[model samples]
Target: MPGAPFLRGDRVDLRTVTPEDYDFLLEHGNDPAIRHGAPAPTPVTREDLANFVEDDDESVQFLACHGETPVGFVFLFDVDPWRDHAELGCWIAPNEQGEGYATEAAALCLDHAFGDRGLHKVVARVFEHNDASMAVLDKLGFQQEGRLREQDYVRGQHHDTLLFGLLAEEFEV
Candidate 1:
């Protein structure tokens, strides 16, 4: 707990997602609140997640930790080396929300995306109704770029998908 973190932050560390962490993903990742931004419709099986962790070559993913405890996840996906861009995605456990973990992890991912990965830009698509996620992006200096009208239907309601983008030059830290 006193040593260096995998990717150190003020309040959290970002480390590679391991096979053992899939169990944690199964439990926290499927919580209804956490699923609000997830692309998949249903909870995934361990096998499905295993394949995801193994087959995913375009994304840079990390399991968020606080002193060795897994609290959430962050990812930069849909990476296009030629295009110099990627899509950002992240989530904190329901119990861990509001502690600033998501923000720090996201910022770290952006650092890796821009500093380490040398990407020109990063983008995110969030649900219109999810103000919390939108606020997180806003705090990270992402600009609202566009919106897709009623692009998602969940809980018997249609919601627009808001697109946010941040250029490498726009990154603050």
Candidate 2:
């Protein structure tokens, strides 16, 4: 469990990551299904996750939960208060996928980004092979901006990264 959820959605709640959440991330974050689109160079250890939650200040991260059970996490990276933009990243636990948890969590975060954070735009980069992630972005009204051909080499194969963006004026929430 987290200290207290900073935001809540229909199906999920967003909380700042806690040390206790590291084990959950270790188990689910390393799943091949979850890591396929978002590559992890090596298996992440507890210490690394601890550092990420405790030390990294460049990004804002939240763990999503349905009740007391963790469902996933959402992130706003490279946030530029001056530019009024940020890069978004999110993942659903393998067991928790396909239940709209990610979508719900994303909606909550996007609301925060455009409303509370006062960001003008938010961006996302998705692996070419992750159609599900693309669908989530589409459902959230993000427009396809561009593609970086063969931008990432993961799991012994090169993959393209598709960029998507949503402006605050375009966001429904």
Best by lDDT: 2
TM-score of 2: 0.95
Off by over 4 Å in 2: none
lDDT of 1 at 173: 79
Tens-place lDDT digits, model 2, residues 115-137? 99999999999998899999999
Off-target runs (Cα >4 Å) in candidate 1 are 1-5
Clash totals in order: 0, 0
Superposed Cα RMSD, model 2 = 1.2
Q: What's the lDDT of the predicted structure labeled candidate 1? A: 0.87
Model 1 over residues 6-71: C-alpha lDDT tens digits? 588988998887787888888987888888775557778898777777797887778899888888
Instruction: Quote the lDDT for 156 in model 2.
Output: 89
* Candidate of highest TM-score: 2
Error of 2 at 42 (Å): 2.2
